[model samples]
Target chain A: MKKILLLAGTALALAAGTMTASAQEKLKACWVYVGPIGDFGYSYQHDQGRLQVEKELGDKVETAYLENVSEGPDAERAIERFAREGCKIVFTTSFGFMDPTIKVAKKYPDVKFEHATGFKKADNVAIYNARFYEGRYVIGQIAAKESKAGLAGYIVSFPIPEVVMGINAFMLGAQSVNPDFKVKIVWVNTWFDPGKEADAAKALFDQGADIIVQHTDSTAPLQIAEERGLKGFGQSSDMIKFAPKAQMTSIVDDWGPYYVKRVQAMLDGTWSSTDTWEGMKEGAVVLPPFANMSDETKKLAEETYAKIKSGEFHPFTGPIFDQAGAEKYPAGAVVPDGDLLGMLWYVKGVDDKLPQ
Target chain B: MLEAIILTVITAATPLLLAAIGELVVERSGVLNLGVEGMMVMGAVAGFAITVSTGSPLLGIVAGLVAGLAVSLIFGFVTLTLVANQVASGLALTLFGLGLSGLLGEGFVGTPGIKLPSLSIPGLTDIPYVGRILFGQDILVYVSFALVLAVSWFLFRTRGGLVLRAVGDNHVSAHALGYKVIRVRYLAVMFGGACAGLGGAYLSIAYTPLWVENMTAGRGWIALALVVFSSWLPSRLVIGAYLFGAVTILQLHAQPLGLGVPSQFLSMLPYLATVVVLVAISGNRRATRFNTPACLGAPFVPDR
Candidate 1:
């Protein structure tokens, strides 16, 4: 059954490819969002990138988008719809869309599919993600400097490597400043839910965490921190407006440059399936203006940011230990991209368990 | 620290209590409306939109309640007049609500909302621990408590309550006795809708104070389950809501408190508690049968 299905899929893909090849029009690109485009978080950032592509590429390429596409079989339909609508390139902007994107790509071999924060790739599928951990490291330094309670809070979304790495990087960053610095992790197991995220922030605060960080994509945690007169950082987008005085700084995902670059590659006939993970150096991740911190802390954050941007430092450098006190990376050894992309265990100072 | 935990627990529980209390009344009137989740999300989006436009959290809450009531009317009309399957109609209502709320709330996304301020009774609010818990809560918290009392009194202490109960226990007999069974059920469903709307508005206006797609999440379903877990009792509904809320809040703090369990099990605490408590409560067949509306989910044709 599998072999027959594969052959049938290949035949259908070939048919679709020839049909697309027959049409000689402007390149049509499409984007699928897991949340509404107005979420002001992950999806919103992706939409911004889409707009940037249109602005930079001009009439050479036309773009379209479908927001709030749930991940699963539903995502497969959304991606396929873009293909049927003559979208040469479709960007699935969520980790949960990985399998669906790959499946859709298999049936539309001529169409290029780019998935964000995902690991899987096909002949026509590309994977791209920002090294958000790089930004997390910088914020960790600021948290260490400003936190009077010495303990920080991390409101986590899932046990996935992407979220786990952010938690580890944040703790490592804090530990770099104060070796005895501790972090408390509260896993809400959801990517977006304002109420749950706010409650998690309160729970962390009640447990003596003066500074809060979140891997989830809502500004609720930051808002709660602001209301409680505490300090925290934002996720995905710059959320200084939401929490003003409470936000130390936000780790903003700047995907506009990367989006434009990829479309340019497609237009130039140089597009190919590749894994792209870019950080501050590549302008993929940016930290908004530092605020609500002392001048001394600001200088330290600026110095760290500059170093990361200049490739002078990597967040996962050397001598790392799991929560069980087991050495995962030896002294002076930097963690490989594959390891960072698939991180599963917590760092030594994270007061939480990694669910299997 | 304890105060902060208590505050969060109250915030989490209030929405569940509000939605469950309304559902409890509906179920008592023999209408199995599974559309609480749908009504709640509709309320959430409408509430957020109104609050954003009018700059008044109070008006936003009212809009949410109206939105929920409006959606419930569709379910009531279909099941009551058309004599449709209550279960199927309820499920359709949920799907409709989720989709429409997403469309309705499209433009309101990412906008910062004004939080409903807590009631500060001056001197009483200044009394440290006692003051903050009792007096520092928002107006909705007090309203929820009053609802529990009002519903309790209305259900067990009034002539109207007996008639509604009779209609639920045996609709055919009630209809024969000229009790207007369908009318009674419709009123109960609308009340349930109003409460759910208020719960959803509270979520968007006070709890998180922001609008996001699917902001109500699965709290409406949880509220529905809470109705059953309370064995259709108004007072027990409060206990169930708080227990669920406490478990949800504590699951996050479990690791910080150094419980040697895996975070996955801790994360499942609320759901696990729900299942365990539900099974235990439902184990008593006599008690279960006595509390449950005998004609629940059954189509009632007054003419027949």
Candidate 2:
């Protein structure tokens, strides 16, 4: 009887310990945004992903976010605060947050860090970016089919590889429809400025562009296009409400599934650092229902989108030429991911000089 | 293309001209309020919010002006009444304004705005090159020009203007002469705030016709630089503002116009031009001595 009582006590103590451990397994997640959540653009979309994590995990995970956190030193502090606050996983959502995330990850090696639209990675830091160029290519097809002047104007923030890839993909998609299609680029060197973006749009409109494509985060370009009865594509989030008549389609960023999956991995103790670049196939970049287009154009856009998803159509398929008419890619060959990731030159039909 | 470019240049220049002209008067009265950026952003948010709610750009402009004035009064009380350091106070004002505007403008983001219509002068507006510029501008454009002319005439010609300038040139002497130095400074600061507010309203209503955080994009700083670049002269302020505007607009067209230089260099045109012009203007010591307010950025204490 004495032996049996001792064994029962040991079993009870072990079960109690297991229960306490499970209770402490509740995970804390944090996100750092580069702009105010009300931007209704880039930051807004990222915030939605944070919400998705909460919804998916319910009581198992708690999430928080710090908005309008500028890049550089400020970002490092914000990330560190999350780590110090007992957050197990932190996601820094902006390309500029790359180094800051890495720096903070080094100090808090146990904290898992996920950065978006960045290339750098460490043991504790995982980089993820959506193939936004894929969405740009789809929109470019729609713009080409519907453009009255066969001229599209692109308003970009910087000449980074990501932005350059979007421009090249857009032009390539347009060229597939109209071989003589041309694109004029105006670099604003800012991510969000409604006034400047609007001005750029008007300037491009005055220069005879009927379709405007923007890599910057603002509804101003599309709104300006709506005001002038022109068409454009939205960036970061769906902006159809802001420009119902003008938005042909928007490159809606769906970071929800990815965020939920990452949190799940962390919870299961199977988290590992890796780089993820998912496009339409992985559902990172989604397109809204086609609008401001004819039935035929919409059908064609759908078909092209499916082809991209199925790996049948690639935007950077060779024979590609640089702006200077030099062949960069040979015929019947698709550009490799390594080369596309570091693209800096504009395609042949782009009239702007690549700023070194 | 030339017509379009000119139109864009005008739109860009008007806000800078308005803000600079206001700061010019404030400096002429012997006070340096570095809160132009702060006040302008306040105007932007207040203007955008009122316009979005009321659906009237006119009321929005008024709210912007009043909002800017309200913010400037805080600076006025701090620097003029509390005798705080002008430079530090102004910097604090900018930080405050940016933060406050971001908070206030949270709800106004992404909302479509009503564009203030341009003034159509019938037949005169139809004339090709010079017509749209001189006759077909918006009401605020004319207001900006009128303010410049009015300020120029007021500063150089009127007795009141002389008293104001006297206060700026030498506050102690002006106080000895019973010129009400603090009162004059207060009015000058308020006027500067109102002008900056108008410039901000012009940005949200007429410039972009929409609201976004940090939409001023350092235009207020550029305006401040223009005041110094123009040697505090209202007429020169116009030249500097337009030149800056022209450079900004032309940079966008450089590549299309077949200029083979990199876009980054083109992007730096306005700022680089400002530095070059400032250096050239500073080289002439006589001009600087003649125009810079003797009491600029200096604290004044009136002894009863």
The 10-residue segment of model 2 chain B with minimum total lDDT is: B250-259
How many steric overlaps are in each model, in order?
0, 0
Q: All models: lDDT? A: 0.87, 0.86
Which pairs clash in the backbone of model 2? Answer: none
DockQ of each: 0.48, 0.24
Q: Write one digit per residue (lDDT tens) for candidate 2, span B112-179.
A: 78888888888999998889978888888989999999999999999999999999999999999988
In the range A220-271, model 2's lDDT, one tens digit per residue, is 8898899889999999888887888999999989999999999999989999
Q: Model 2 off-target regions past 4 Å? A: A1-26, A55-60, A310-312, A319-332
Task: Give TM-scores of the second chain, every candidate.
Answer: 0.97, 0.97
Q: Model 2 residue B68 lDDT?
A: 90
Clash pairs for candidate 1: none
Q: What's the C-alpha lDDT at position A293 in model 1?
A: 94
